[model samples]
Target: MRLNQYIAHHTKYSRREADKLIESGRVNIEKTKATLQSVLQEGASVFIDGKRIVPKEQFTCIVYHKQKGELVSKSDERGRRVIYDSLESRFKHFVYVGRLDFASEGLLILTDSTPVAKALMESHLERTYLIKIDGEVTKEMINAMEEGLVSEDARVGGHSKSEIVAMEFAAFAYYEILKNDKKYSKLKVSITEGKNRELRRFFGVFGREVLDLRRIAYGFVNLNALPCGKKRYFTKEEYKSLHTFLKEHSTKESKKIESRH
Candidate 1:
């Protein structure tokens, strides 16, 4: 693994923070100061500021209702608000699975297990969202998205496929509605892929502007009854379900890597 990734996996700091530490000469490999470009071979001992680094003992997963204006990163160079500030102090080395933009807020999964984070974030795991758009959605646009439309911007690397899990049209005064006027319409859209600003861009193609976006679910996890800007610990069963999924996926990936070797 890369030096920064190794340090991030072993420390409470995020990957970006780990890179900063390496650049500042705070990280060491085998008692020698190391840089971000350094590589960590298998079974190599690492240290941070003279303290031996160790793997986390217990893993924790949390469901946080991220509020708008809070950056999802662990540390922002610009001194912006971050999600870590609201996390419980008892957690030693937790990292977020995915990110929500500063203007967006909803369910975000945080975990101490790097492997679990990697599996959920880097894989094809599905995520669901409820979005409020600025105008009435046309049936043609809905059909096009369901049939997998080719995005003109191509911000998402792979082909885009969106299925409207549920659709509801109501007055513009819902609590979740960020915009309310006689000219605008509200929609709750759900998609599997969690691409960057995907919901907004998807609606943008149809000339609709997304006023507000909120994630409601991720895989088997849901944000039911969880108020905005608060967090709750995952139940034992929820943890077990995630753990098993991660273990199975990791094992398959490891075998694939071995075969390539």
Candidate 2:
């Protein structure tokens, strides 16, 4: 783990705070000042403000059912309500996994463990969503979903301010067309990658506007029975499954590092 990540996972300090501490020379590894690029090795002595940071044996994870009109952010410049406003004060410091966009809603994963959050978000775990769109579901759209798409001008449905103009969409893991008509369509779709505005952009290629989007699941986590705006801790079985996934993920990452060396 990097120094900032180490501080974030082992202590209450966030990654940004850890960076600041390191920059200010308050963080030391083996009595030597640590830099942002410093990588932590097992049994290495790490200290901040003259005290050792002992890694916590356990971490907390939770799922929040985000509702439409809520931004997945800590704050908004335009004064719109953010997820933090709906979350309890105790969870104020927890980091959200992936975003749910302002108009989208449903299950959102959050955790106090930075490593866990980073791992899950970067993983190619399946994300399933329920989406409603304008116009009928066409054969071309189905072909794109099945064969994947590469758009050089994918800015159509993306945020106007987004700099991304090109995007590569992976083939959807699964999709079911629940409804179809000249005026509207609805579907359940699953994809592995979580590119920015991916689903919207894909539909934009077919000139269909996404009317509603709600993420129902990510990997093994689901939003079952979780009311909008409500939050809950992971069940024991969920925790067990998560730990298993994390262990496997960590092993794979370590192997990649070893291979690179």
What C-alpha lDDT values do all the predictions have? 0.71, 0.91
Which lDDT tens digits does candidate 1 get at residues 41-85? 888888888888886547778999999999998788989989887
- Clashing residue pairs in candidate 2 are none
Expressed as tens digits, the lDDT of each residue in 1-261 for candidate 2 is 667767876887877899999999999998888987677788898999899998787999999999999999989999999999999999999999989888999999999887788899999999999999999999988999999999898987899899999999889999999999999999999999899989999999889899999999999999998999999999998999999998888779767856987
Supply the global lDDT for candidate 2: 0.91
How far is 37's C-alpha from truth in model 1 (Å)? 24
The lowest-lDDT stretch of 10 consecutive residues in candidate 1 is 166-175
Error of 1 at 230 (Å): 1.0
For residue 84, give model 1's deviation from the true position in Å: 1.9
The ten-residue window of minimal lDDT in model 2 covers: 1-10
Prediction RMSDs, each to the true structure: 9.1, 3.3
